[model samples]
Target: MNKEILRLPLYTLIAGFILGIINLITIRILIRGTNEWTLEMGKTVFYIELILSIIAFVFIGILLRQKYNRTDFFKSATLLVIYSAVVFILEQIMQYWGFYSMINSYLYLPVSIFTVITSLVARISNLEHIKWLHVIPSIFAPYLFLLFSKNPSENTAK
Candidate 1:
């Protein structure tokens, strides 16, 4: 397997983890006057996270467009799954540290599901066919979850 094939997903995982930490810190600093982290604050941070993830996906897609090659489906799927799992684990750690008390699911489940789909599609499709359309599901996932979920407050972190 070409090491290059692994670069985009790995870079995305590392970047997302770092950016998530930075986002939590920045939000905490900005909301220092508040006695407790509110749902609104959590939503703000999550929205920012969603945007960051989208940006990362687009950047990676563009960066690798010319260079991306079709690899073994299982290998590509495994790498993407690992990327999703690591991201979810890191976010859980952040939540455990009290950074995501007001958030539920932290966009992990939906994002992971959509990410794997988007990545697999991109990986298997012709380079020319990999476009912004591939990311629409991911982009809508958070909003869709929020719209369809039962009381968001009930699902807040313990």
Candidate 2:
């Protein structure tokens, strides 16, 4: 990884929000054919997912850049795992406290993908291109969950 990737937290955050909006646009386009989405819920999920995604993007970008091809890859990976675990725990805690909630299944998929991709970027040191085989979970899991949610059984029938 380049030394500069480690230096600019501000750029990362701004660029991350840019990616958040890109994610929002992608999600909007994705949910376009679904009758299941209400405007308010779409807005809410966009903001939530965007914020969470950007957070993961920035942290993972920074951490990966710093650790890529260094001797500390395992240590970096372990930290990523711990970070994801904490996010998962905090999300559950928030639900328990009624701070906010999603269906339990909604909670895990994104976080798991986040960790997997974080590990990928850590090892590969490339952003413009990803190794799809390694990062496919991030590429597909959220949309798959969205698709599965549209299944009739999710809403009504078996």
Candidate 3:
């Protein structure tokens, strides 16, 4: 049995969980106030942090591909799902602890999706003949851009 199969996905899962932890901690500190002024600031900080995370995923995913020679698309997607699930579970647990609210928590789902898609694309790009397949991931880049472009409502930004 090839070790790369287990290694890549496991590493991705761990990295995803770590990043999610960082995200929660950063947001907690940045969003200190409950009023409108602080709310707006939180929204900006959230988007900025999300973008930075996405960028980090892109680079890390690409590096993983180079190191492990990952080519299976399903494996890549599954790895991302693992990461997303870990973050979601952590967020839910935190909410239950009264550290964060449940309102608009689903918004974090996109971060996981976009990060995986971006990383998958980066990996697929390395293939020799499937030149067009590499472009599919770029489509999701607009979604990432749109995330930053929209004005998050106070109610949904939580």
lDDT of each: 0.53, 0.46, 0.49
lDDT of 2 by residue, 1-158 (tens): 54432323333334445554665686777678786767676556545554666466556545544324332333333343444465556755876798765544343442442534444453467455444354444433222222112333433432
Name the lDDT of candidate 2: 0.46
What TM-score does structure 1 among the candidates reach? 0.48
lDDT of 2 at 139: 33
**How many residue pairs clash in all the candidates, one count each?**
0, 0, 0
lDDT of 1 by residue, 1-158 (tens): 66765655555556556666777687978699878878788657656655766665566555554444333223443566554556556656876798865343444432442554555456567565656566544444322222222343443432
**Tens digit of per-residue lDDT, candidate 3, span 105-140:** 453443442444544554446653434344345333
- TM-score of each prediction: 0.48, 0.35, 0.41
44 Cα displacement, candidate 1 (Å): 0.7
Best-first order by lDDT: 1, 3, 2
Clashing pairs in 2: none
RMSD of 1: 16.9
What is every candidate's alpha-carbon RMSD to the true fold?
A: 16.9, 17.9, 16.5
